[model samples]
Target: MSINYPKSIENLIKQFSSLPSVGRKTAERYVFHLLKQKPEQIKLFAKYLHDLPNNFKTCSKCLSLSEENPCSICSDKNRNDKIICIISNFQDLLAIESTKKYNGKYFILGGLINPIENIGPDKLNIKLLVKEINSKLKTLPEIEIILALSPTMEGETTSLYLQKILKNPKIKLSKLAQGLSTGMSLEYVDENTLANALKFRGIIK
Candidate 1:
């Protein structure tokens, strides 16, 4: 199981393999592909890697990965500030946005509650969500927060906790409709199904 490549190539392969779902063989292939690229192209690729963390920062407003602090969606005047869709992560937020059925703001919880995995409420951005909502309410008359979570047990647990913490007559809470079915991840759901779920979301009352 000896790797005969140069130290530089070996290090690059190891780094690539560290990425999610990438095996050592695939990482080697990627490194070889980069070797075939023009010198300028390789420099450009390296520059992009160097700049990724500097440019793509976690949005302060919605906790999403974006170039801007508030992110384009959070700062967009056309987006409805009165409605905020709380999703498990940035991918789920993208999935919902792809449907074009929702034009509301979003709050990206870093993850859902899963006690078995040691991921609790404190691990996610729940407190920041409450603070953001209260701050927004200062300007807006009222706001509706939708729990756009997955149908898994963890998602349910997170949604219930959000409901409990956000319980109030002035603030409204809701969840995606039954059409989403049970045990489906929002990130992998089809556009039509997700769109319908948003269209017919149910109030938490």
Candidate 2:
């Protein structure tokens, strides 16, 4: 069914629809909303889009997206350096931060293990994480690693692999429990649920 939209409108719809989980109808709605915006607002939006890549840089330590190297969280001296939270992405880190229950460092895995996608243990930043942990051990006697990943099959797989590689008597590995529903990403969980999960995190053994 052709909507008979003009070339520019159709192109905008196509671009919006290309985004994750965005359907054609949603894309059309987005395009219409954009069309309703003032020219100044539209230009500002386009400027932000154009400047995004250059403005944001991935943190060297945790791999989280930030404007500065080491990122604010990593560089913050007040945060507990002995406890490191391993997360799947920057969004998950933000979700946890919103709770204010966890005052620790973070290590972003970048992505989860998916055999179909050919994303194995080597594909992630596991090596860098291990290096960071080992380097930190010299200053700190003991450290806690929190596996703050989603409860999906890929999350489990990645967690298990991390457990095997990071097993150490001096290090304690734990994961968020109870309040988190199964198969839900941390990024989308409610603040209350996330807070409870952090409060009652379970030891991985």
For every model shown, the clashing-pair count is: 0, 0
Give the deviation of candidate 2 from the true structure as CA RMSD.
Answer: 2.1
Question: Highest TM-score among the candidates is held by which one?
Answer: 2
Runs in model 1 lying further than 4 Å from the true structure: 1-5
Model 2, C-alpha of 87: deviation from truth (Å):
0.5
Candidate 2 Cα misplacement greater than 4 A, ranges: 1-7
Q: What TM-score do all the candidates reach, one by one?
A: 0.86, 0.90
Q: List model 1 lDDT by residue over 46-74, tens digit each.
A: 99999988888888999889988889998
TM-score of 1: 0.86
Question: How much lDDT does candidate 2 score?
Answer: 0.93
Whole-model lDDT, model 1: 0.92
Model 2 Cα lDDT, one tens digit per residue, 1-205: 8579999999999999999999999999999999999999999999999999999999999999999998999999999999999999989999999998999999999999999999998999999999999999989889999998998889989989999999998899998886677888879999999999888999987
Q: Residue 119, candidate 1: how far off, in angstroms?
A: 1.8
**Which pairs of residues have clashing backbones in candidate 1?**
none
